[model samples]
Target: MSRGVGLLLVVWLLACSGVHAQALPTQVSGSVSEAKTRLPIPGATVQVVRTKRGVVTSTTGDFSIEAMPTDTILFRALGYKSQRMPMGGIGLSQLVVRIQLVRDSVRLGEVQVISDRPDRAIINRALRNIKRPAPPVVSGAKRPPKPKPLFAVDSTAPKKPVPTIASPVSLLYDQFSREGKQRRKMEEIEAEQRAEKLRKARAEYNKAFLDNRGYTP
Candidate 1:
């Protein structure tokens, strides 16, 4: 029984020592800034090199991450060179770090572009070489000339009598009527000409009136 109690005490001590050796996770805070300007760099990537855990900086270039003392942190941002820092020697529970990022310069080479378009003249020459069939010709027998009218008009058929003026009065009346229509048409033409002349005279008078009033019409 005494031996068992001694063993139990040894186990308890070992468990307590193990719990004491394991450290609690600590929060690390850091800011990324430009090296020359010393201005905060936002949206920077902060990653643990060993565990692959990562976080991004806020708009104010501030970041907080849970990390162990044995981990190494990596900082990266656009237009800036990447930086790696070891966290083992940092002793504070809430560690605050200020990181400066250097600018990276890149040089590009000249580039040339070339284009080739097919020749239109060569394509047209190729199309003209293709053979085509000739148009068909129409060939048929000629129709006989139409035969003469079967027979001369039958002499036995009565002839239609020709009409003639029965009296001189109708002819004279028709002549008088034609003369009257011609005279009326002449009068109408003269009236239209007079009206047109009057219109032209009115237009000239109006133009003169406007000119006298110091206005051009």
Candidate 2:
């Protein structure tokens, strides 16, 4: 009986000294969220600083980890500041510890936009080379009379036999006459307008190219 009492005392002393505590790891469960909005931060890493082992928070921002009182745990997530806490501070009696992480601001470096087209200088030069046609100058030229219709149509007068088809010689003369010169001038004006439109279109395209890349020049 005395021997049994002594053994019981030794067991009680070992229990009080926490000799078995090392074998029993503390279960640490917690949640992480955005501090300002109180929104759960899923995929956040909960790592043990000493062991480097970690666990990721669930979609609901819930996590469970086994750690010792002496260990330090770190909570980290993308786009948010990391947090550290001592395991001892999270007492065993505490249920779910709520960890709210502040949003971390990240500044990015300058971004370079690459393209296959020519640079600004080359594009500008190309646009400048497109020239408008000059207006024609007809010095000492008189306004030519309108040509009469080849065949006149009248209901009151009896229709005469169809006039002979215009001779080839007359056709050639009309093509090289003042009327032809005026037609050519009108064509030059149209060409100038078309060239101006093309220049404007190119300028607009360059502006848009720069704007899309956030470039100014």
Candidate 3:
């Protein structure tokens, strides 16, 4: 009976080793692409289902991950439907997988963009109202001659051509009118003042000369 128990224990150990060998992780490498176009999908997520093991595809849509035969591999990417494949058939050997993802066809709502454009009418009106600047004056340019006044007087007068004869009425008015008498009186008074000033000036000069000569009057 003890021999039989030893054989059963040995059989149980062999079964456990076989199971552990089958559960060993395998290096899985793959490329993901679009279903319709067959174009490579970079940055695609390659994750082992029911575990945290995952990897992201490279620019060439290539990925490498360690996964057990019992685990399921999930491929996900933006704008594409998710895909899953069981790793059981691949076994412990290194395998390269090519997965094609279908495009998600859920249409998005239309977007409206409003641009801030000034009104064309206002712009045209502003352009029309803009006053053009006057032409620039050039230096050292000859200027046009200025126009003369309507009633300009000439300073150069002609020689005597015709002498007007005064009438008796005009001659008597100049000699006896109140204005004429006042004017004659003013002229006489101006002449007397001039004579008095000249006499005083001549007397001062004679006195200065006699003093210089030591003469007494």
Candidate 4:
């Protein structure tokens, strides 16, 4: 029984050793610095751009990561240019590289402006020229001028003035007075003429009646 237990312990130890031999290496440790300043830079994202593997640098600019395949050690930060290290001749399993970041260039933005207005030639000239009508000749008769409007009025009806409140009563009164005076004069003349004719007609009737009655007219 004791010999069996000792053999079991040896088998367990040998199995553990084999497992350790097959286990993968955890990571590669590294640091990053600025190319110009030669100062350590923290927070640079160290990536293997080709394999999509990466990690951010620590506050002390140190990083620990698994190495990826060739031409793929890509380093980047917010305001810095990216850097790539070729791993063609180097074994990534032995990778412990220092990265150098350069400051990125800033480009100024561009703008374009446009405005709208009529060109000078277009506003000054007619689209097409045409002959104008000849002016009428003056005559000795002193032609009655086109009568100036009774009132300078609306665009549609220049001869008719829209009388305002201040002048309306006076305009109305003048109109009514002229009508009444003309009517009164016409009636007076008509009445006088009618009275004379009535008198003449009565004399003629009376003379005819007297002559028929055998009396002198």
Question: Which prediction has the highest lDDT against the true structure?
Answer: 3
lDDT of each: 0.76, 0.78, 0.81, 0.69
- Candidate 1 per-residue lDDT over residues 1-217, each given as its tens digit: 6999999999999988766544555688979999999999999999988789999999889998877777899999999999998877454567888999999886669888765866899889988997898877658857689766423333443232333578667556545678756755776787688667656655665674545332122
Candidate 3: worst 10 consecutive residues by lDDT?
A: 154-163
TM-score of 2: 0.46
* TM-score, candidate number 1: 0.46
**Local error of candidate 1 at residue 36 (angstroms):** 1.0
In candidate 2, the residue pairs with backbone N, CA or C atoms under 3 Å apart (3 or more residues apart, or in different chains) clash, namely: none
lDDT of 4 by residue, 3-88 (tens): 99999999999999866644433356779988899888888887766668789998889998765333457788878888877555
Q: What is the C-alpha RMSD of each candidate to the true structure, in Å?
A: 18.5, 23.0, 20.9, 23.6
Lowest-scoring 10 consecutive residues by lDDT in candidate 2?
A: 154-163
How do the residues 163-214 of candidate 2 rate in per-residue lDDT, one tens digit apiece? 3466666556557779856766776787688667656655665674645432
Using Cα atoms with residue i matched to residue i, what is each candidate's TM-score against the true structure? 0.46, 0.46, 0.48, 0.36
1-217: candidate 3 lDDT, tens digit per residue: 6999999999999999988788778888989999999999999999998797799999989999988887899999999999998976455668788999999987989999987887899899999999999999999999898875433343443232232365667667767789877877777787688667656655665675645432122
Most TM-score-accurate candidate: 3
Query: Residue 147 error for model 2, in Å?
Result: 46
Candidate 1, superposed: residue stretches over 4 Å from native: 1-22, 89-91, 111-217
- The list of candidate 3 runs beyond 4 A from truth reads 1-3, 114-217
Q: Count clashes in each candidate, considering only residues at least 3 apart in sequence or on different chains.
A: 0, 0, 0, 0
